[model samples]
Target: MRKDIHDYDLSRHNTFGIHATCRRYIEFSDEADLIGILASLTEADHPLFVVGGGSNILLTADYPGTVLHSAIRGIEPMPYPTSADDILVRVGSGEVWDDFVATAVSHGWYGAENLSFIPGEIGASAVQNIGAYGVEAKDIIYKVEAVEIATGSCITIPAANIGYAYRYSRFKDEWRGRYVVTHVTYRLHRRFTPHTAYGNIAAELQRLGIATPTAAQLRDVIISIRRDKLPDPAVEGNAGSFFMNPIISRAQYESLLATWPVMPHYDVDADRVKIPAGWLIEQCGWKGKSLGKAGVHSRQALVLVNRGGATGADIIHLSDTIRADVRTRFDIDIHPEVNIL
Candidate 1:
């Protein structure tokens, strides 16, 4: 219920350590408080911004309007006439994404096991359809609830309407800045199937010496693998993976395969093939290459890290150079996974 200016430097707040400022910033704790704040806003005068864990973002300049820091936090079972085995968890937008995954796995929830250690929040996950290891967020989402910024009306948008794809959702483009996600409802089953077919998941399970691995084992193994693969934001400062794996036509992939012969790829569609951006980046020799405190991660080529005191402009410049180089060399455009603001 108070509106006052505070030290709003977004450097420490955002995962990238980009020094940027917001004009007005406010944090709220619950749904009612969010609703109350929304009711106070004048529709045309206030341009709204909602920030979650500040993981997958880069701020180029100071905002000229209100920045609403989403803090609606909790996890509760959805009320309904349903079977006991069927569970629906409502998570606050501010809930740490990876922590939520850990909780679900510990509770024997099956859906989020492959998506361990991803950054950002529960609500932002749906908007971006965050994916890793073998799973995507939309795979288990039941529904997403949001408060309309313009009118302060609450809505339960079904998961199908989200238009999920590889690192994308309708929310990223069409519904951008349209809603402040209050909570997300996910249906995780008590007795469920497991996903262990992708990447090193099977190998990790074997290394753990389990014929039949429990959900906890899978979670632990995945966390271990990602810990080794990705640089921690606490030390090096990163926004996880920097680029989306580019999907090209099968003919196009075959052309590259004909040249490289050992080119690895996965089927994205009937004609489209998805290639690892890391492989492409490493081919370009950008991994561990530094330019003015911003560089590709030495350990993982897919991740762009702030080695020290890099500004937003510095990171983007590095990214632009990478993208342009990749496009020129391979004739394949590399798109950034992180959203630039």
Candidate 2:
């Protein structure tokens, strides 16, 4: 296996920029290559894990298992079998997620504009159900194709078959180590319908003096918003939005709202309300503060950054401290959106 590299350095692979290595690292260019690697691994009885752009993960320690990565990259326009106003596009797993969004916007395609500037690849996009500005990947994903690692069998699963929720799918849980995503089919609208209701998108659009904006314009606004808030991984060594927003019952939200009148919240449903994790973290006085090499990002309290030379343990310690403080203060549990491995 010429593609298999031993004692592979993964310090540059993950966005957290943590120093870690794997026993073996294999890069597969296509399904045939993936099948070959899977077959070999299956016979060898070696533990394995699949990785994408490495944007949404925190490497806590050197992996003891073989790390399989996809090199499959391409975007193809599929036949639009549905209405005339909708189109289908199949994207390879290794394609950069933001690049695909940019392509869609450039072509005047809707639905992905609000997802602009999100990190990671197309495979993780569908798997993680990555979202921003009120738009989630599940909303646009039509079908997903993956290769079973144990059997080397390829299967195409429709969107309906995939259980999608806030920042999660079966790929993150039950099917986590079982399948390696090969491609994702996205159904996008040909007609533009801007979604600027969430966050400060509407106000930003107004501030920019833009009305009836195009997809590209909307993407630009999103990029600007992200740049203004989130820290760049290249410079800061972080996975954006380290914690998922905590969803509480409406009764719980009401109880907290009585104490803090201005606490921001979003209605998840009649039963639940979503509270910003950043606010909770900031309230705990962890914002822009550091514990050794690990620090809470100043601009976005939700992000945990490596000041420099921060090990995985340092981050975990800092995160634990923040979580404990939030629980003590708000009686809420905020969990990491970034996968800690």
The sequence of per-residue lDDT tens digits that candidate 2 reaches over residues 1-341 is: 33689899998788888999999899889898889877766434367877887888888888887988888889887667968889999999989999999988888667998999988898899889999889899999999999987788999999988999999899888997889999999999889999989999989999989988888888999999999999988898998999999999999998998887889999999999999999999988999999999999999999999899999999999999999999999999999898888
Maximum-TM-score candidate: 2
Indicate which candidate wins on lDDT.
2
Give each prediction's root-mean-square deviation over alpha carbons: 1.9, 1.3
Worst 10 residues of 2 by lDDT: 37-46
Candidate 1 colliding pairs: none
Lowest lDDT block of 10, candidate 1: 1-10
Task: Write down the TM-score of every candidate.
Answer: 0.94, 0.98
